[model samples]
Target: MIETIVLDIGETITRDDRYWASWADWLSVPRHTLSALVGAVVARGLDNAEALRLMRPGIDVAAEYRAREAAGRGEYLDDSDLHEDVRPALAALRAAGARVVIAGNQTVRAGELLRGLGLPADLVVTSGEWGVAKPHPEFFQRVLEVAQAPARATVYVGDHPANDVFPARAAGLRVAHLRRGPWGHLWAGDPEVVAAADWCIDSLMELRTIVGG
Candidate 1:
């Protein structure tokens, strides 16, 4: 009965408004330009990393992100970066006897950041630790192994339809699409994608109704 709840880190649990603005400031690009870049990538169904590389070929995106985290500057979200609804929703799930965890394509430092934020997660796993990314069978297999949950009894919540919704569903897990961030807002117009999700919610709080308690 929905014993395990898997959540995406970026956009799903953490809001990115301030984060993106910070990135724009760091790169000396106008906020609108950054937004346009993201939009262009999403529209072309291209990876964001590819878009960044095309925009500035020599820059190392991963290293830049690491530097930002180290310097305490630009788009690095901490405990304060969490959306208001995250805590209460997660707390409710835990109280309902559910094992909630963070599963996403984050860096090695993600576990420390999530823990420091005091997020209500039993575990925080990343692509780094699992040696694979989302939409891959191995990634979901790792998640299932860690949660020790059968597909039918688990629900995955995330903002991206491709990385979060489709893949988790393909793994036989119920999916909840939280329409808040770039991917969510951009893909919201696709009726087929929207309807495919077991639950399309505007807030994390709605998870309570979808899962239980």
Candidate 2:
């Protein structure tokens, strides 16, 4: 009885191909170079902020983002940026009376942006708001508190194996590993991660069959 479905924002619901491209342009670096930097940062377990600082010393990454927002640039996720399946899937789950939550490793503006975009979500939680990020037990605990549902009755859907699947499972929630994202494709063949998830999906539409919306 999965009464609630928690989802990851980036890669899972929101696609940031254009956003990353803009960031590369701002930094005057090639898109692939920026992608490699992101991969290296993740591989070495470094904070994204720290990675950016290394790339450009004395530049405030947050401030640059704010400036971009102010300048009507890469500030938010447009309809074009959202994965095609997100809206209908979310609507189906809500129609079936399942609570839908967006809890992901995102900045403070993430919730605001999602809300402003009018995404179908009952609650939006971010690492910036929670003061802790994923892979941390406390963060998931807070989400559960907001959900007010038993862990076994909740499912976390995300692309990151370590950040979303494993930690949510450790927190006693069922996990769904969503393929087709950075972390998804990166860790695709890992038997430990794939086997650990209760479900693996290439599209959010698959969730309809698994959760029976």
Q: Which candidate number has the best TM-score?
A: 1
The lDDT for every candidate, in the order shown, is 0.80, 0.82
| TM-score for candidate 1, residues paired by index | 0.89
| Candidate 2 per-residue C-alpha lDDT over 119-199 given as tens digits, one digit per residue, 9 for 90 to 100 | 888988789888999989998898788776899888899988778889998999988899876678777778988778998
- Give the C-alpha miss distance for residue 38 in model 1, angstroms: 1.1
Best-fitting candidate, scored by lDDT = 2
TM-score of each: 0.89, 0.87
Off by over 4 Å in 2: 40-54, 57-74
